[model samples]
Target: MSEENTPPLPGYEGMPLAMLRHRIRSLGEEDLHRLMAYEREHAARTGVLEVLTARLDAVRQGAEPSEGDQGFQPEAAPPPAGGSPVGPASAAPASNPPPHGDPAQPARPKGDHRPGGGTRGGR
Candidate 1:
């Protein structure tokens, strides 16, 4: 289809995919069919096809259009082992190292006595 004639993506033109899928449930059967045909003719992505097909099928099965939050809900990341949750007062004391070592200050072996390895300028 020509650029001007092609339909806009389900939600606002630049909306994220998760939001688009949620909003797609609100489209009428005719709108969904139009979008499916457009997608099949243009991008033809399997994920997009699956969502469109499922929503269309639901419409055919007499399901009412969804009106609530059906979009993705991200789970909170688990706290690091021996590390505290992030907050304003979670900073470690200056004298002690954090449970996880800091990358800014690398560790070196104590009392190093390696033979003739102090300076790199000598042959």
Candidate 2:
């Protein structure tokens, strides 16, 4: 499809399924059709198609567009300017391994060998 027929929503192609569902609620049937057509002509994703079809069906059944600006996507908002707040001071102390092998199975005594020289007792 040409640019003229692009989906009504800006950044439509990049929208995740959940975001699309929320964004499309504010759109009318005509705009939904346009988006559905664009989706079918391009990606034709099954999940997207299902969402579009379900919404269209709802619209055709007299469901009005929900309140909210389609362009106002909080989910797509950029992360905070500063990087992570975690610092060395807030980090957990490093752990050291046990000196006597794993905690689950403690190391045997120096002369605790079995008769057959096996490490496990009898069995």
Candidate 3:
């Protein structure tokens, strides 16, 4: 079947249902809390929302280690014995993000070779 023809992801079921599933699947525990807050405020679904909300609460209370917080890292580490970044700050967003080349920095001009800092030398 064509990609377009394929049924949409489960969350497409409805805002309350589909978003809850997608949020639960894709988001970290902290993010799930944020989603749960929004879910409770608007478009709340008792059954589906409860499942996700329970998960959010479970994470908060340390009732159990979360689904896969087991080994995920800020930058995914090579998997090891212990799980996700541990301790109080692990769930918080990174303050300094991993580097990306700065788009604002000007690019070096192409084929503009020079000697002694300019085109001073004779050919």
Relative to the true structure, candidate 3 reaches a TM of 0.31
The whole-model lDDT of each prediction reads 0.67, 0.84, 0.53
lDDT string, candidate 3, 1-123, tens digits: 653332222332343454344335545575566555655665566876677777767666765432444123333245588777778876787677436556566556546567456543444
Candidate that would win on lDDT: 2
Best-performing candidate as measured by TM-score: 2
Ranking by TM-score: 2, 1, 3
- Error in Å for residue 30 of model 2: 0.6
Task: Output the TM-score of candidate 1.
Answer: 0.45
- Pitting candidate 1 against candidate 2, the one with the higher lDDT is 2
Cα-lDDT of candidate 2: 0.84
List pairs with backbone clashes in candidate 1.
none
Per-candidate count of clashing residue pairs (backbone under 3 Å) = 0, 0, 4
- Tens-place lDDT per residue, model 2, 45-66, is 9999999999999999999998
Instruction: Assess every candidate by TM-score.
Output: 0.45, 0.59, 0.31
Model 1 C-alpha lDDT per residue in residues 25-119, reported as the tens digit of each score: 76778878877787777677788778889988999999887654423333224567785578678876568546667768776655544556673
RMSD each, Å: 10.5, 5.9, 19.9
- Candidate 1: minimum summed lDDT over ten consecutive residues — where? 68-77
